[model samples]
Target: MQRQLIQPYLLVLGIALTLSSCFNEPNYPDTPSADFKGIFKYTIAAGTGVGAAKRDSVVLTIGFKDGDGNLGNDIPVPKADSARYAQNGGWGNYQIRTFRLINKQYVELVQDVNKVLFFPDLTKGKPKGAIEGTIDFRQIFTYGSSFKMYPTKFQIKIRDRSLNESNVVETDTISVPFPN
Candidate 1:
């Protein structure tokens, strides 16, 4: 009887140890800092419409450093000047609030109808229901190009949610270099 109890305890302890060790971070990234060079500019573009007409540019630039904790000037991202969303559900019920990058893989462009504060919902107040309009996701990645230049590409995705009227616009990407 004691042997049976011991086996179960050992098994549990083994699992706990394994789980803890799984959290150990690995020092490997698909797009390592070494893979890039010189000034890298990440920009948030306004695809179309009044948002495009009223484009508020935000850019980030990385100086001459191979990831040794060095960030340089902020350069504007390439402007698409071709992205526009037509009003589908309401009458001029859209307001571009914020443009943010979520994690290392998501760039979100928000358009809230009700002008809801995304902080309370996205950060602290995660609503379970829906949100208004749609969010576009953009990713910037290097195509393993030349040594002097790592040409980047931007990928875009349109995602729509349901809610009364919340203005939260974000355009994010995972391919962009993360700030240390």
Candidate 2:
């Protein structure tokens, strides 16, 4: 009876140790990195009469990896630090740039507002280690009635809490629907 109990306990212990050893943390570089995963386009209809308009929305997905696992900001920016955050392009950790193809060339579309987005802390409740995941960012564009389909692309990058910027990733040319 004693031998039987000891054998079962030993087997369980051996199994647990084997499983734990298989879950080794990834050893990625401290600097963040990103890659273009995919792009999806959709149309959003709004209004009825003269105010009617069709807006093109694009969701861009990118894969990111960070070694230190410090990829986001969970705390809200205090009022005193608002100016500092704004000076650095808002309080977003991800920066996106839009480009429209014109005359067989890509020209960056400069907007009065910066296209920055904030992501919540991604390492919550997890051990300090490298993290890899995909993030989807959506953008909407509206054009005049005379406009039609337009070819556009985007470049994106991410920044960690340590202010380390990831490698820039660019999406392939995508056709965007415009008002006709």
Error of 1 at 86 (Å): 30
Best prediction by TM-score: 2
lDDT of 2 by residue, 1-180 (tens): 999989999999999999999998889998999999999988887767774677778899999999999887765745444455467756468888878877999999865444446777889778888999999988877656677677989999998877778999999888886456
Per-residue lDDT for 101-124 in model 1, tens only? 445433444334323211111212
Per-model C-alpha RMSD = 18.3, 2.7
Q: CA shift at 130, candidate 2, in angstroms?
A: 0.8
Off by over 4 Å in 2: 47-52, 75-91, 177-180
lDDT of 1: 0.29
